[model samples]
Target: MEGLLTAETLYLALGMLACGAVAGVLAGLLGVGGGIVIVPVLYTTLGFLNIDPDIQMHIAVGTSLATIIPTSISSSRAHHKRGAVDFSLIKIWAISIVIGAIIGIAVAGQVKSPTLTAVFAVIALIVALNMLTNPNGKAIWQSLPDKLVAQPIAAAVGGFSVLMGIGGGTLSVPILTLFNFPIHRAVGTAALFGLLISLPGTIGFIYNGWGHPSLPAASLGYVNLIGLALISPVTMLFAPLGAKIAHSISKKALRIAFGIFLLLTSIRMFSGKLF
Candidate 1:
């Protein structure tokens, strides 16, 4: 085991620490689980370790979902403390989101890396478009839709979030704002949904990838414990700082900036250069 810590590995570990720091701030500031950043980094990390190409995306997604647990907890707690959370919406959306996440986990296990990569790219494209086209966040309706419509929407958010290894904020925050909810409240509630999605996503990925031979060291199934250990605490520490930033400034600029990032990410994914 001592032999495992090569110079390259040490450099990778430092990169993950930086990734976690950035992810934590994003999680709190944007209500995302930082899975967007974490997934790609973990994917690259696992590939760098010479894990099988076939399963690398799965492991990345699973590990990213695992990391989201702490990120969501820290971000959500910060939001809750600030009275930004709306439990009523959380209560309404919870079950559907869990169901979608379960289905996503099952499907992820059955698919190959290319498919998963495409899913991420497509989802990222959609999110990027949303952010770019509607950064100002105009409401589509004066109020949220009733349960029948709302549940399906929530399910989509959860399912896509799991597929992309993202927290619900990537989808949920925009949807909430479109339904006329305040952005801060939308971000807070999305943080809770991140928890809902990650809990099931982590377990399902673990079960799905259990005993896979190509997984890296310290892996519990596809969730790499090393990555988790290295990333989670750092994210927790910085998430509150993001929350503080979110409360202090308008997100329109950040929204546009992130949209550009997502756009580049989507284009990169679609170009097949990374895969």
Candidate 2:
């Protein structure tokens, strides 16, 4: 325990600060929980601490979701003020998404780090391709599918996002746009989805990882307290700024820039699968 405390050095603190800053902006601007950024950073940080490779991805994913809780709140509120959030959709998708999240936790516990990383890479690639395309262009459909069909998709988004250590915005935003939602509205609604995906995700991870022998100091299951404390505050501070940028900026530029970032991130995630 003493050595674990000693390992919480300046390097970890600085790394988390920088990670948080970028992640915060991405959260608000991209309507994501910023897990694409958080997962990798936390993974690397834990590696530097000599954490068990078997559990590193689990901790990173859990911590990333934990941090997303507040960031989604901040980002969603900002979008709501702009009339971009759809409360009806929120009500419709809430239950199924939460159920999916719980199932995701169960699945994650059975997988190793490589499998989780692979899933993240593949999904990130898909999202990057969607973003690079004309995200706000003509839609395939006139409106969302009926609730019976849509609920299952919502469940999948929640579960898949848990595997990727995300807030579900990366998946939800694209899905919403496919159903003819405006870009801003999709982004806003996805911000709420982040909350739904993350709250249960964090709890499930903690519960699943309880009494794990490999966790770091100040860990609650797979969630790292120090990392959460260091990251969430800055993300909250910047999420509103990101939301402001999202509303004010040109959609095209946002799409292209975010697309490129995800493309690179996906590639990197793919390359890091062995670790």
Candidate 3:
């Protein structure tokens, strides 16, 4: 480990720290897995290190999902303390979500890195647009489907979120709110879903990426322990603070700011492949 600390490694470490910090805040603030922030940044960082192109995005996705495990637990506990979590919803959706996540992991392993990047970009753009136009959940469909209808949607949410290395809140929150679930409860429940998604997702990535060649140092399959080492603690530290702030502040401005950020991030993801 000591011998690996060249200038490049130092720079990467610093970058990971920043990514972890940002992800923590977002996880708390948005009840997300922070994969939306971490994936693109990791892609950039690994690109700089000139790692194997074939595995770079896989590493990013795996690491992001792995970090989400602890981050989601922390954020979910905070929200649960405040009575924001709806355990019934979690109970209702749990099995389906897990099954969908397994399917997503299987599919991700078969897809190319560029295809994954494109999928992330598309999803990010949709999320940004939703946040920008419906910051308060007032713009689009305002009701959730019946359980018979919801089961399939829930599965899709889990599958897509796992594929994108996210916590599922990006899709879950909106779906819940449309069904008239309170926003806070939706956010908290989504945090739990992040845990569900990340655990199986991370395991799947590790299994899928096992024995892949030229993985970066400290990688366990596609999951980079070094990245988790740099990121997890910081993210856990900051998540409660973000949750506290979310409760106290007006989120409209924050939503707008985050929307712009997501837009730019999406553009970067899309353009990276092009150039």
* Candidates arranged by TM-score, highest first: 1, 2, 3
- Model 3: C-alpha RMSD to truth? 2.5
Candidate with best TM-score: 1
Q: Over the full model, what C-alpha lDDT does candidate 2 score relative to the true structure? A: 0.88
- What does candidate 3's lDDT look like per residue over 16-54, in tens digits? 898899999888877887888888888888887789888
Give the per-residue lDDT of model 2 (tens digit) for 170-275: 8888788778888888888889999999998999889878999998999999999999999999999999898999988877777787788888888888777422
**TM-score of each model, paired residue for residue:** 0.95, 0.94, 0.93
Model 3 spans > 4 angstroms off: 1-5, 139-143, 273-275
TM-score of 1: 0.95
Off by over 4 Å in 2: 1-8, 273-275
Give me the overall lDDT of model 1: 0.88
Model 1 residue 213 lDDT score: 79
Which pairs clash in the backbone of model 3?
A: 142-178, 143-178, 144-178, 144-179
